[model samples]
Structures are given as structure tokens and as C-alpha cells.
Target: MYEQISHSLLNDILNRIKPDIYQKDLRHFYTRLGANFYAIHGLFAKLYGNREDFDLQAQRLVETMARQYIKREDELKQLDIERERDYNWFLNQKWVGMALYANGFADDLKDMQSHLSYFQELGVNMVHIMPIMECPEGQSDGGYAVSNFREIDNRVGSLEDLRSLSEEMRSRDMLLAMDVVLNHTSDEHEWAEKARTGDSTYLEYYYTFESRNIPDMFEQSMLEVFPETAPGNFTWDEKIQRWVMTVFNNYQWDLNYNNPAVFIEMLDVILYWANQGADILRLDAVAFLWKKLGSTCQNEHEAHLILQLLKDCCQVTAPGVLFIAEAIVAPSEVTKYFGEDAVIAKECEIAYNATFMALLWDAVATKNANLLNQGIKSLPNKLERATWLNYVRCHDDIGLGFDDKDIIQSGYEPQSHRRFLIDYLTGRFENSFARGLPFAENIKTGDSRISGSLASLVGLQYAIETGDVDAQENSVKLILLLHSMILSFGGIPLLYYGDEIGTLNDDTYLDDPDKMDDNRWVHRPNIDWGKAEKRHTPCTVEYDIFNGLKKMITIRKEINVFSDFNNRELVDVGNPNLFVFNRFNPQKFHDRVLVVTNFNDQPQKLDLEDVASWGTYKQGQLFDLHTRQKPEIFNNTLVIPSFSFYWLREM
Candidate 1:
């Protein structure tokens, strides 16, 4: 990693390092800096090399990393060493995550700590607390608009309370994941306030223009992220008499990575949170980091470089902290967030498998696996060191971002099929049991997204409304079936908060003026402890879902073959209603499990002769790992009951 020009610049930067930093732990700091300097220098140069103070900025970057390294606690440093020794530790199958809003789950961070045992009871070892950063009360995009990066929102808890929560989770051997909004900051942020006051230095930290000439040019290629709510990419700031890039909303201003100072500052913020015990930092809106005039201003090449630089910088200080790329793009572009490297994830260690998630929804609505199987086959293989964050649902609206070619291959017209899904899920179609709302419907393009909790979208809400016991039973089975796929889907299955007990869409958000416009808030229900208690009551919907998910998590943790080391093999069983795949431990050929899911409401059969190559399906007795019983077999075939799944292992 030592290059002549970059290392020469590194030596210059190191010599100018303050005596206090040099005397504290110079050996350790210097070694890490030296190793990562080449990539850092190259990336920084790519971003801000044309500047007059390029060398000075490089010096500042090194100083920023050094200060953070000096403040990093001994325990954290020890963790860094341990993780370095086992670089691929995160790819293990034992890690199951649950994403939740702290306040929604409990009263506050302190109350959340008290309920850590709740997560333990559900067999969840990783907790992703949605953004708790300070923001303007009404303008906060569910905590995405950050007014202060260092302070935890008082409504959630103080920094001390968060620290206590992290400590408690660590004690219970649970990983803590928090959000760091890397793309933009709230207009109420101190930097924005300074810019409003006409501070030139701070004004340069964001993308601002005095006229509409450049803004109009950029708009030609830029797609509106929230067309229904926040229409344009740039917002005119009345205070400054200028237009600023506001990709998400008017209250959120995009930072200028073209400025080296901004890059160095954000890097410092990342390391700061890592020191606060965030084992994983979900970098928000990473694909929008860099903007170009003639491009969509997303997934730009420079954006990838920025992530690579950020990862390299973090490695120098807090090597143990991993990054989850929150870029929910197409399947082709999603894997790039893990970086282009073959064996190493230079950008992020984990990414959201949005394609797989959307495809699963397709299977649910069509009652077939044709699209799911074909769509998954088209998904590009991820990097070796990286893994996926698979989920049935999350806190965001689900967009049908499948490839048109894959849809055609599955025998569906792209445009009409998407419309069918929207209609079916919104309950506009006759006999459709789903209770979902159409989110961000684009009138011009006829494109829309679906927003609702898994339980509601899968018919639990409708079943309860009609008081249909049979419908209720089928809904519960479908819920378990969807989870079965994600659990065995070769990644970390992320359970959304409240989904464990079949919590329904909370229409209460419709009553709030601020939340009424965003239907995604419907799924962000506040957990009712009173209702949650019913999870222990036999035959209740709560009991069926909670215990069912807990059972899956328990089984998933015990299977080494489930680890995501490129061991999944999709099987085409000729039955369009069934989706089948095999998971195996790469190190042991004999250790394998065949996962078969029936999307039909009637019994479906998979011929054992077609899967004889899977080793033992032809002759040996097979047991369902989920039920711990032999599957019903007849005439050289396995019968999967209505809306059911099986984890078949040869015994």
C-alpha cells in the first residue's frame, strides 16, 4: 500500500501531527495510518485533488482520524483486534437481527434496556434501533433529518442512556446497530443556520447556487425521490436567496462531498459513533453521496470512491465497527454498494436485499414462485466477505423494483403486472384479502409502492375484521411461510418490530397531521405490551406468530450450512407454485438442507427424482427440520401442505 507520492504526503502529515497524539500511542496509530494512507490519499485526491490546500486537507484528514483513535476506549480497541483476527465473523449464521424504533418498542432508551430480555426471548441477537439523532420535531424524517450528529434526541434518551443500552446489549452478547445519516442534514442543523447567516466557509459545505441555471441543468437527469411530497431536487432558501440541493425533502439539505472539509468532518462523525459502541453503523442514503450534472445523481462512480475512502478511514481507527449500506437500488446496482472488490467488501460489509424482498411480495400476491425463482436467479452474487440483510418487511414502503426482463420471463407484462400488484395489495381487486395502502403513486408513470406491516398485507387485518377463523389460520400460516423463506435465504433475516406478534397496520398515524401524508407510518406501530402478553397464550394469533418466528430463529442459529458462503443452490422443480433451494456447509459436503416453500393454497408435490442429485432425496428418510417430523411422501414425491414450507434434511 506504500506509494511514493502518497507516502511522501503521509510522512509530511505524520511529522506535523501534534505531540500529544504522537506521544499517547504513536506506534499503534502510526502503523494503521501508514497502512491505510495510500487508499486514503488516492481517494481524497480523486475527490479534492484540484484544491489549492490539498496537502493541508490531507494533513487535516490524518489529524481527524488520530484524534478519534486517541479517544477510542481500550475495550473497543481490544474488540477491534478480535474482529481483525476473525474478519469473516459477521458472515456466520447465528446472527439474527430485528429493526425497531426505540420509542415505538418502548418508552425510551432506558425502557428499551429493561426489555432487552424481550429480544432474547425471541432469539434475536442483533438490534437495529432506528435513528435517534436530534432533529426538528415535525421536520424529522423518522429521525433521518439530523440537526445534531453527536446528541441523541431527548425524546428517545440522553447519550448516557444510549451508552447504558449498548453496554447492556453487549453484556447479553447482542450487536447494536444505529443509523448515521450520511447523505444530508436537517435544514435546522447548525451548519444550515450558519449558512443562512451568510457564512461563506460553512455555506460551501452544501450545494448552493445563486441562480437557477445550474439547478435547471441538473434537474434534467435527476429523478424526483418523493414526487408526491417533495417534488424537486433543489429547494429555494429564502434566507440565503439561493437554491440548495434537497434530494429528500425541503428540510433536508444535501452535503457537498466535493468539499474536502465536509468529507473529513463526516469521517470524524462515523468514528465518533463507533467509539460509542455501535457495532454496526447503517450509512443512510449512501448512493446519493456524489452528484454529477448529466447523471441521475445516484450510484455515481464518485459515490463508490467516497464509501471506499470512508471504509479505509474507519479501518484505521475503529476496525471492529461494520457498515450496512442503505442503498436500496436495483439488484444489479445493489451489490456494488458492497464494492467491486472480489473478496473484500471495501465499501460496506452488509446491504439490504431489496430485490429479494420485493420478489417475495410478488410471489405472495400471484400465488406462484415463477417470478421469485427467476428474479432470484438474475440477482448478482455478492462479494465473498459481505452478506445480506434479508427481511419480509421494514420501516419503509416496498417498491416493486424488479427487472422487466425477469417479469417477462415469468410470463407477466411488466407494466400491467405492477398495476395488478398495487390493486391486489390495496384490496381493490375482488377476493383480495390484503389491507395495504398505495404509497407515493406517480400519476404520470403509473408507478407506485406498497406500505403496510407484514401481518396486514398478508391478510391478518382483513381476517380479524371479518372474524373468519379459517381465514385467520391461513393468514398465520402465510406469515410463517414468508418468514421461512427469509430465514433460509442465506443471509441475516431481519425481523421488523411488532411483526413477531402479527401486529397490524396502525391507522392511528392517519390522525396525525405530520404523519398523515406518509402511509409508511402505518406499519410503524407502537408495540402494546398488553397485547404482546397474548403471545404466550396458546391458539392466539399472537402466540402462533411469536412462537413460530422464535422457533425459526432458534433453528437458524444451529445450522452452520445456513451461513452465507455462496452455498445456496436454487432448484427448478417444474411446479410453478413451489420455490425450492438447497443450503450446504461448504466445508462439509454431507451437511445439507433442502428448503421447499409452497405458495399455493392447496397441497403441492415436488418429485424426488428431479432432485436425486441433491444427495439422498431419492432413498434416505427425510425429516422436516421445522416440524421435526417426517414429511408425507407418496409415489416418489414430497407433499407440501397448503401455505406451508419445509426444511428437509436427510436422516
Candidate 2:
């Protein structure tokens, strides 16, 4: 940590530290900076070594970390020490999270603070309030396009209000997660505005070119992220008389990480949020951080280096804060966001389990686990210190990003199977109960994603519309079954805001001109307090789902075996209708729970002898953790009811 060359550079930087930073206690800062400066120096060099101002940039990076450390609250510093002592604190089973839009969930930050009791009632200890940063009204990209890095949107209340909400959450023993859009900024942002006015310094902040030659070359390999809407990766800036890389949309200008100034500025933004009491910061659009001409411009090595540098810098400033990688790439590439380290995560501590989420949807539509079983088997194992943020639904559309090999092994053509899923969820297929809409449909590849609330996509909307009691019951069972998988599937289970009360897809966005173009808004509904009240009324759809999920959350927190320690073992039970796995405390093999789910419309039986290798399934009295009832076992075969799951443990 204190290598000669690195420490010599550190000593020089420390002596030249600005008066404001040197005025602070800085003992802790010096120790941490010394420990991490070697890696930081190496990464910063790799990213900007060729620049004339490389040494100046390194000095600025160290100064930025010192400034943030000076601003970090005393209480937060104590929390950092505590978290360092228990490095695996976040991997515990007690941290269940819910992702929601601040304005949609309640009125704003203050109103959301008033409803903290609602979160506690549902047993949710962590809450990820989606992007609420300042942005242009109509061009906000659902709040991802930021106009200001330090201010909260006026619609979502002031920064003081957000601080109050975070403080309240912390007092109640809850964690607050916020989003930091790392990749780009709204065209109306001050930086972009300056570039528009021919400020040479600001012009270098973004990817701008005078001619179309380089843009054309890059377009040859760059895939259009919004082909239906934006069409290409480069947008011609009329005022600037040049082209700028706008990978997401025309109004969202991508930042040039090639500029060390950009990296330093973004690091300041991350630390500012951490000081505001964010326990977790969701890094948005991380995979597209760096771009090259000859490649697809995603998951590039430089992007990883940027993230590693960011993590190391944050560790010195706010070690209590964790990062959730928002990269929803291929199954193989998704784990890379957790970093290449075999036992520890050098980048992000958590990532979205997009493949597993898609696989669960496949089982729901097919009424079988053939693809779900195979796809999960293909998912690479993540690092021990890193975990997954597993969920059934989020603000985004459901993408079937399954590996082609797994699809072939499951006896389906990859292209046709993907088409089938789009058709099935969009209600274009026969006997389909789903009421989802197709989002981002690509005419060239016939590829698209599904958009709708969990309740609507899983048949609750249609069942309620037709007033079919049997269909309604089946939908409720399907909802609980999907949740059971995420809750016990070796990660932190994230519940989408409206899923607990069976909130249906909202068509209100259809009337708004700004929102009509994006069907993802269909699932991002405003909570109806009148309907949410039904959650307390017995036998209602809301009551069934809310209470059912509450029980699972309670059970999950009590089960130490559910903690993610790479202890999950996928069991091949030789039954296609049943998806089975085992969860056990790695230290105590005898303490285990066998999770079994029947993805069929009819009862499925699993022979206990087939899973005898799991030990507890061989010869013991077992009970369902949810129902607390003895499972029906006849002739050494266990029967799983249709559209249901069991978390079985020896009684």
C-alpha cells in the first residue's frame, strides 16, 4: 500500500494539498489515501497517462477525495468504520429493498417521509428512490437526464427535503438508495449549453466532431439504443455546427470520460450524494461509459477501469456507501460489473440479475421450468463479496436477454423463442392472459421488450376485467411464486413499488404527449391511495398479495440460510414442471431449506429420493415455511400444487 513510487507521489500531493483541505484533521484521510493511492495511481495513469496534464489530474483527484472526506459527517465516518469491521454486512438476509419513483410513490420527498411507516409495515428495510435530480421538464428522460448534479428536482422537493427523508429513514433503521446518472447529461445542462456557445474548454467535455467521417466509422459498429425514436448514436448539434455522441437520445449528450475533468466532476457528484445520507448509489448507464470505433461500444475494458477508480476513490471518502451496477447486459457480462476478482468485488458490490428475472417470466408464460432451469444453470457465479439485486419488475421493460446456447439446450430456436415471448406477453398469442405492450420494437431484427406492471403481465389485469375468480386465484399464486424465487435465490430481493398491492398497468400515460411515445411509462403508474387501502381488507386481491409478500419478507429475514454467501445449490430433480434449489448455511450443512416451485397449471410431483443428495430431503418431516403445514408426501413423492412454491425445512 505504501510502495516507494506511489507513496513518493502521495507525499508530494499531500504537501501541496489546498489550504481548505489541509485545514481539516486529515489523519484518517491520509491513512486511507495512502492505502488506496497505488491502485488509484495505476488506474488514473491507464485512463489518462498520455495527457500533458496527467500529473495535474492525479493531484486534482487526490484533492477531490480530501474535499469530500472533509465534508463527510462525523456520524457517517463512524458508520464507515463499523461497515469496514463487518465487510460482509450488506450480504445479510435482513436487507430487503423496494425501488420506487419519489413523486409516484407519494407526493414528494416530504410526503414520502410521512409514509415511512408504510415501508416498515411491509418489512422493507431498504428503499431505492429512483432519479429525482434536476432536469428539464419534458426532456428529463424520466429524470435520468440531469441539468444539475447537486440539486433535487423542484417537483420532488428541495435538497433539504431529501436530506430530511434520508435522515428519517436512517433514524428508523432503514437504508436510502439514490441514483447518480454517470454516463450523460441533458443537452440543456450548463456544460452542454457552454459547448453550444463555442466554449473550447466545455467543448472538450463531450464527444464532438466537426465532420461526419468519424461518426460514420463509429456508427458502423455501434448499435442504435433507441432506433425507433432517436435512430442513431450521433446527433448533429445545429448551434455548435458539429456532431455529438447521443447514444440514448438526441437531447442526452454523452460525457467524454477521456477527459479527467469529467471524471473528477462526476466523483464530486457521487460524494455529494453520499454525504446526503445515501447508503447505496445506483450508477446508471455504466456499461456505455467508454467508447471505441471498432467495437460495439459496450462493456469495454476502459469502462471497467473508470468504475474501479471510482470505487477506490469512494472507499477513501465514504466506505459506508455501496454501488449497484445498473448494467443489464448478457448473463456472462453482467457478472463482470461485479468485477473480475474471484472472491471480492473491486467495482460494484451489487448488480441486477436481469437474466434470472427474464427466466422467471419465461416459466410464467410457458407454464413450465424447462427454460428457467437451463438459463439459470448457464448464469455465471458472482464473487463472494458481491451480490445480486433480484426483482420481478422494475421501471424498465422486460428484456429476454437469455443466452442462445441455453435456448438451444431448452429445445427452442433462440430467435423464434424471443419472438414467442414478445407475442405471448403482448397478448398476440392464443390463450395468453398477459396484457403487456411492446416497447422499443426494432423493425430490422423483429426484437422488442415487454412493458406492463407485474400484475398486468402475470394475468391479474385480465382476470379482474373478466371477473373470473379461478383466473384471479391463479394470478395471485403466480405473483407469490415468482417473488418466492427472488426472495430465496441467493441475493437481495428488490420489490417494485406497486407489485405488492397488484397495481395494474396505467393507461394514463397514453394521454400525455411526452409520455405516449414510451410504453415503459405504462408500468410507471401513480399510486392510488383509494385502491391501496384494500390491502387491509381480507380476501381482496390487494389483501392477498400485500399480506402474502409481507409474510415472505418476514420469513426471509429470519432465515440465516437465505443470506447470500454462494451457498445456493441448483438441484436437478429430473422434473421439468418443478424448478428446485437448496439454500443452506455454509457453516452448518444440516440447516437447509429446499425450495420447490411448480410452474404448471396442474399439480406436479417430485420424488424425494431423486433429491436425496440434498440430505434433508431424504428422510425427514418437512414443512412449508410459508404455510407452516406439513407437505403432502405419498410413497416418497412430494406434491407441489399448481402455480405455487414451497420453502421446505425439516420440522
Candidate 3:
């Protein structure tokens, strides 16, 4: 990798390194830098070489890494060495995560530490504290509109509070994940303020233009992210007297990665948080990183290059830290977030499994696994080193992001199926159990998303409201069914904050003027400690879901096959209501686990001979790993109960 020109330039850059950085013990830093600098130099050159100051930018990037390495604490530095030796440590199945707001989960960062026992009780080891960074005073896109990248929001806690929380979580072997708004920032940010005052250097930080001539062209292919609220991609900034590309909303201006300085500055921001003890940084809105004309300005090739460069730089500084690409695109394009590598993820170590998530919802609406099986079979295989962040719900709307061709192949027209799902989930369809709400509904395009908490969307809320015991039990089974899928579907299962106790949608958002327009806030609930205490009671809904998921998580961690390493195989069981997949222990061939889920309200039967025909379970007595009991079989057929799944293995 040490080409003559690049390494010669790197030698000069290393020689120019500050004496303070050189005086420190940079043995591991230098070794990693030397190994990664060639790729770093190439990516930086590819991004900024035509500029006259490319060499200067290269020098700046190196020094940035050196300075950050010096700032990295001694304990974190030692942890980096340990992780580099155990490079695939993140892919372990023992890692279970939950996404929550610090204020929602507890009171703030200081209070979050006191509630660590709550997560431990639920078998969660990684806690993704959603977007606590400083944001604007009013309606801050639920904390997504980050105003200060390096400071925690005053409402949440002080920086010292967060550091203390991270330290405590590390002591307990728990991972701390925080958000970094990579694509855009609040209009009130310091950089945006400078741009408004007509500072050319700061203006270059964003995609601002004097006229709409270029923006109109860009608009021809760009799609509206928030079609109801923000109808266009570019917004007219009165203060700057210019149009800036605001992909998400008018108040959130997109950063221009075309500027190499922006890249280095963001890298510095990233390492700053890494030094704050964030184990994983979720890169928000990563799909919209690189914008281009005559295209959707998403999933561009240069975007991959930008991620690769960022990851390389991150490796040089904090090798232990990981990245979760929040690119909620289609299955065909989503895997690219992991980079174009067979065995290495040069872009990101993890990505959101949007397709899998959307498909699971479709199965919930239709009570069949035909589309779920078809959609998963069509999902492209991810890289060996990269894995997925599988979840039933999060702090967002459900987009039904499955491919149209998969719908057609599953015997349904694409648009009609989508409408049917929306109607059914929203309770507009006949006898629907869900109480979902509509979001971003568009009349012109007939496109919309559904928003509700997991409980509401799956009938727990409606069942409890109507006081139906059978229906309520069914809802509990469905809730556990969904969690079981994510827990065993070959990746880290990220349970949303309130889902552990079947927390229903919070309609109180309708009273808040700032949040009323956004129905997604209905699902971002405030954790109810009073109701959460019900989990300790045996006959409560909270008890069933919390205990069920805790058992599934414990079983998942005990099984080596659940560690994602390209070892899963989708099994076609010849029954439309059943979804079957096999997970094989990479270390032992005989230790295979067969997972079967039934998505019907009535019992479904799949013949044992057909499943064993593949020689997978031919030689063993089947036992449910979660239940520790043999599966019920009759006449050579296995019976899978309604709204239930089994992690079965040979006893």
C-alpha cells in the first residue's frame, strides 16, 4: 500500500507533526496510521485533489488524527489496542441494544446512570441514547436539529454527567451509543450563523447558492423527504439572501462534503465524541451525504468514498469505536453502506435493516409470511464483517420499504398492497386490530407512512382498551413474536425504550403545538416508571412482554450460531403462513438451529419430512431452545401455533 508518491508525501507530513504529538507515546497510533494512510491519502486526494490546497488539506488531516490521538485517554487507548487484536468483537451475539431518550428513559444523563439496572434487568448491554446533543429551544426535530455538536443539551445534563454515565456503563460492560447528525445541522448553528453574515469560508460549509437556477435543476430529480411539511429540497434563507439545500427541513441545512475542510471538521467532531466515551456513533441521514444533479442526490458513488474516508480516519484515531449507518434506503442500495468489500467493512460496521423491519410489519398486517419470505430471499447478502441493527420499531415512522417486485412475486400488486397495509394498520380496514396513525400522507403520489408504538400497531393498545382478554393475550403473543424475530434474525436486536413493557402510543403529543404536526412523536414515549413496575407482577401485560424478551435475549446470547458471520440460510418450508430459516454455529457444523415463525391467527402445520428433507434436522429430536420443551408433532408434521416462533435445536 506504500506507493512511492503517497508514502513520500506521508513521510513529509509525519515529519511536520507537532512536537507535542511526537513527544507522546504514539507507538500504536503511528503503526495504525502507517497502515491506513495510503488508503486515506487516496480517498482525500480523490475528494479534493483538483484544489490547489490538496497538499495542505492532507497535512491538516494527518495532524488532526495526531492531535485527537493525543487527546484520547490512556484507558481508551489501551481498549483500542485490545479491540484491534479482537477485530470482529462487535459481531458477537451477546450484544443487545435499546434506543431511548435520556430524558425519557430517566431524567437526564445524571439520572440515566441510576437506571442502568433497568437495562441490565432486561438483558440489554448496548444503550443507544438518542440525540442528546444541544439543539434549538423550540421544536428541535425531536433533538435531531443539533445546534452544538460537542455539548450536551442543558435539559439533558452537563458534559461531565455524560462522561460519568459512559464511565459507569463501561465498568458494567455496557456499550454507549450516541447520535452524530452527519448530513445537516440546525440553522442556528455557529457555522450557519457565520454563513448568514456573508462569510465565504463558512458559506462553503453548506450548499448555499445566490439563485434558484441550480436548485431548480437539482429539484427535478430530488424527492421530498417530508412531503407534507417540507415540500422541496432547497429553502430560501432570508438572512443569507440565498437558497440553501435543506434536504430534511428548512431549518436543517445540509453540509457540503464537496469541501474537504468540512470533511476534516466533521471528522474532528466525530473523534471529539469518541473521546467522550461513545462506543458507537450513529451517523444520521447518511444516505443524503453526497448530492448530484439529474439524480436523486442519494446513494451516490462519492457518498461511499466519503464514508470510506471517514472510517479510515476513524480507524487511525479511535480503532475501538464503531459506526452505525442510518441509511434507511431500499435493500438493493442499503448494503452499500457497509462498503464494497467481501470481508471488510471500510464504510460502516453496521446498518439499519429497514427492509427486514418493513417486511415484518407487512406480515403483521396481512397475517401471512409469503411476502416476508420473498422479500428476505431477495435481500442481498451483506459483507462478512458487517451486521444489521434489527428492530421492530424506533423513534420514526414505518415506511413499508419492501421492494415492489417482491410484492408482485408474492401475488399482490405493489400500490394496492401498500394501500391495503396503510388502511389495515390505520383501522380503516374491516376488523383490523391495529390503532396506527397516518404520517406524511401524499395525495398526488398516494404515498404515506404509518406511526404508532409497537403495542398500538400490533393490537395491545386496542385490545386493552376494548377489555378483551383473548385479544389481549393474542396481542402479547404478537409483541413477543416480533421481538423474537429481531433477536434471532442474525444481528443485534435494538429494542425501543417502551417496547419492553408494551408501552402504547402517547397521544399527549397532540396537545403540544410544536409536536402536533409530527405524528411520529406519538411513538417517542416518556417511560412510565409506575407502569414499568408492573413487570414484576405475574399477571400483567408488562410482565409477559418484558419477561418474554428477556428470556429470548438470554437464549440468543447463549447460542453461538446467533453471532452474525454469513451463517444463516433461508429455508422454504412449503407453507405460506410459516417463515423458516436456519442458523448454523460457525464453530460447529452439528450445532445447527432451525427457526420457524408462524404469522397466522390459527395454528399452521409444516411437515417435518419437508424440513428434514434438506438433511438439516434429519438426525435429531427437536426441542425449542427458548422453551426447553419438545415441539408438538403429529403424523410427521410439526404444529406452529398462531403468532408464535420457536428457536429449535436437536436435544
Best by lDDT: 2
Q: Which stretches of candidate 3 lie over 4 Å from their true place?
A: 613-620
- What lDDT does model 1 reach? 0.92
Model 2 bad stretches (over 4 Å): 615-620
Candidate 1, run of 10 with poorest lDDT: 611-620
Query: What would the per-residue lDDT of candidate 3 be over residues 1-651, giving only the tens digit for each residue?
Result: 447778999999888887888898888888999899889988988889899998889999999998998999999998998999999999999999999999988989999999999999989999999999999998789998989999999999999999999999999999999999999999999999999999999999999988999999999999999989989999999988899999998899999999999999999999999999999999999889999999999999998999999999999999999999999999999999999888899999999998999999999989999999999999999899999999999998999888889999999999999999999889889989899998999988788899999999999888989999988999899999989899888888999999999999899999999899999999998899999999999999999999998899999999989999988989888898999999996678778889999999999987877775334333237889988888887766788999998888877
Task: Give candidate 1 misplaced runs (Cα > 4 Å).
Answer: 615-620
Instruction: Output the better candidate (2/3) by lDDT.
Output: 2
Can you write out model 1's per-residue Cα lDDT over 1-651, one digit (the tens) per residue? 338999888878878888977788656667887888888888888888999999999988988998999998898898898999999899999999999999999999999999999999999999999999898989588999999999999999999999888888888999999999999999999999999999999999899999999999999999999999999899999999999999999999999999988998899999989999999999999999999999999999999999999999999999899999999998999999999998899999999999999999999899999999999999999998999999999999999999999999999999999999999888898899999999999999889999999999999999999998888999999999999988999988999999999999999998898889898999998999988999999989999999999999899999888899988999988999999999987778779999999998889988888785564354348888999888998877889999999998888
Per-model TM-score, in order, reads: 0.99, 0.99, 0.98
